[model samples]
Target: MWAELKKGAAVAVWFMFLTLPIMVVKVNPIEQTVVWRWANLVWLGAAVFVLTVVGRYCSRHRTELSAFWPDAHPLLAHPQLKRFLLIVLALLATLFPLFFSSYQINIMTTALMYAVLGLGLNIVVGLAGLLDLGYVAFYAVGAYSYALLNYHFGLGFWAALPIGGLLAAIFGVLLGFPVLRLRGDYLAIVTLGFGEIIRLILENWNDFSFGPSGIAGIPRPGLFGLTLSVDDAIMYIYYLVLLLGLITIFVVNRLRDSRIGRAWIALREDEIACQAMGIDKTKTKLTAFALGASWAGMVGVLFAAKTTFVNPASFTFLESAIILSIVVLGGMGSTVGVVIGALVFILLPEYLRAFADYRMLLFGAIMVGVMVFRPQGIIGNPRRRSYPLPMAAADQEVGHE
Candidate 1:
């Protein structure tokens, strides 16, 4: 225990020392470039200290921490209560805009966007058991598809939405082809490289992509020649995202209950067994990638239309990381879990803007703590049944966690 505490403290110190400049420091050519602020150093020290203490404590009380939500466990197993809670949540979400201000509605819209992104990634990483680190590449593809189409061809948002998704689905196939046979870290590496490749291409190919300066004057979404005022526009985009999020949830649920979903689950659990059972691994993987990418593509259109701009910077590795984190944090295969995770992570930063500089620091701490104490995530996949075990085995599981 003493050795572990020392190691944890050393690791925390090393991380703060290394990433302080990169993550906590800021520089912008468009704004005040190369400006160094000393405030973050204090916050960094505090963050590191807190993380080290929490890490050491969690290491010791692993079992106690793992059983933190024992009361909620039985509730999760109850179908009627689960359905009731879901209905209440749906009602609250559907009527949110009416009770909130436009700004609040806009925030909810962003959360809903992340929810969709999280759901898409959940299908790939959660259900298919594939680790995709560069899923945002597909998001960039979708956004740029809409931007280029609307820019030169005079296409509307609705016209570009499906086209953009289709194009992204094609890209998904292309991405899967190169890394289809790879698994674990190898697949993650390729996907990460793929995302960087897409971003770099966009950054350099100024003629086609407009580079870092970005494409401006992109058209906002319109409904059949009905141009909404700014106030109405916020609500319009909010409802648009809300509708898409619902559709994504519904479709993914249907897919989860389908034969393909079962095949994907089998493949996830044991690829050798799945292949022996005559499951076509390649097609199953490609379909998973395509479906996930398609959702990202559709949401990409909504994003571009809402912002009315497109830039390579908008689709960075950080965006991909956050989306994937949401999926894993939310409990992968649980749609409700994804939504809750999205809202918590996305809005936590928003609400804690008073400590803006420490936002990422706090976020990182929360995620680390969760992983340390609750490895299965907040609302772990409901379908993954945990058979009651002997006390010895249960205690062992808790220790491992």
Candidate 2:
């Protein structure tokens, strides 16, 4: 009886949230830029409400529900049903832009960049167990690398993409060499200092970077000599980001399961044990740093094109922290979890227009809450094997390992 009530309530809540897209009103344009869709806010609210109700209901009638019927749970012991639900979700994500506006598509682009960045950071913090607080420095390097190279050399935006990644990888090696012996707080502090140092240089070095004023008019990405700026530019960027995001997910997943990836996990689990087992800690660590930085670099190129500008403000310690939080909150080492976390973090605040001023406050609170209640993060583990597995197991299996 209680299970049925829970199910009814859950369905009701889902309907309410799903209706938000058609109900919520937006008064301010700025608020709309980063806010979540009405439907998403509704869904989030419904999820929270249903969870609370289910908790109370289960606490009160735990035995009654368990005894009333062995098969009372509709979603239980039915793997196919779960798979079907997941396929629906994947379909929704792929088709979301088809139904959204240009403005919403732009926001989605930013979210995709965050997703890519989160994936990159996962290598350093999640896989290698390195606390890098200055990851944004590399992001800056990539953006500026592309910005300077494209503007000065008259290179194509497409060409600048990999060049930026290469530049970031070089700096990643330089940073790794010096900080190889540092760990924990010491490593974090150094990385933090590194970010500050880069920002200061960008601010003061007017001749090269044009100082705090920023470099403007960076080119947009193109395909076969055709720029994505015409027609639905946001959609074009979205597909580009999606393709890159998928590739990154695949690469990370493969690496995590491969020999080098195993070495990274061993190092993350125990440096001493890794050393004893003859894993080249130094080389493995550097590879993680380089790969992590390379992703940031690639995203930087995308960002520069997206914004058509590059400045120190774009790559600050806060940006690094937010990216790191996505990795941590999504469940480090879990690609799907990180991607989901990125979506929520990027989209939730955009939808909360009434509480616009409290965006950062809520962000901090959510991070703290997740850390306290779900240390393994919302997805629940670094490895996908451990879970609160999604209702649709087969659909959930679509991404990287």
Candidate 3:
């Protein structure tokens, strides 16, 4: 029975994919009729109906389905299967734009960038156990850096990208210096203030940032002076964001498995113990701050390039909260979990188009539900089998500086 349902879902997924294009194009029932727009909604309803039936059937035969699609089962936990499925999913995502509209590709591009951002925050909050509420400040810094460099100095998007990252890193270090003395709630407050300060500066500093109006007409990324604007350049941007997402994941995973990762874990679990074991807390914490900031910076640069216009409005305390929420909802210290969280937080809202007015209400309710029922997150950290990412060595001798 389980096997039958597992096979059914697999079949249903493929069926949906094959039928979607046809349904979207040919199923214009209301066009000749009176209500074309309503007819399109009807078609959407049909698609949902089919998907619901597939879900119900799959749920009914769980036991046999678990045996066949073992990767879907908790007991059949296999890393190899997980990796295989992830690879397949990545390939599908990479090719999705080929069949999707440019509009859809743009949405996916946003999702991918946030995935990278979430991955970066995962390092600080998940691995390093730092509670940073001002992460978006780094993102804002990166975006503004790119905009300023490109607009003021006549630099291209490609040239501005890394420079933006470097500037964010510098600010991260600068911010880390003063806040290192605080911890837990105090640290969170300071970071929160830090983010607000950046926003205020951008808002008031009309001489540089143009205040509330923000900097516009920023150049888009290009390849060898070839801009992506005229054609389906959105698809090209999607690929670029996808590549950055993949790199963020790869680099994070590698970091998690190394000695640096171990030190971070040590610091996260117990800073005092880590110190007793000759670990340098200051250095470890600073590294976490720096790396996390750098990640945000890179995303910020891409975001500015992608949007072609940015200002203080885009990077707010609420934005920081959402990004941090993705880290929490996805399960801290879990890369794939964060990605999943990013998708849910970033893309799920779009799916709720009908409930536009109640979107925030529903989001708040879901967040409360998650906190109450599964605070550990959907993909909670496994008990064992940690990654082997490297880290810089902690000072062996007594070194507070």
Candidate 2 per-residue C-alpha lDDT over 120-184 given as tens digits, one digit per residue, 9 for 90 to 100: 99999888889898999999998998889987898877888899999999989998999999877
Model 1 misplacement above 4 A: 1-65, 76-80, 386-401
Better of 2 and 3 by TM-score: 3
lDDT of 2 at 35: 43
Most lDDT-accurate candidate: 1
The models' CA-based lDDT, in order, is 0.86, 0.82, 0.81
TM-score between model 3 and native: 0.76
By TM-score, who's the top model here? 1
Which pairs, if any, clash in model 2?
17-42, 17-43, 21-39, 34-350, 35-350, 35-351, 36-350, 36-351, 82-391, 82-392
Which of 2 and 3 is the better model by lDDT?
2
Residues 268-377 of candidate 1 have per-residue lDDT tens digits of: 98899999999999999999999999999988888888888989999888898888788777776778888888998888878778876776666576667667655557
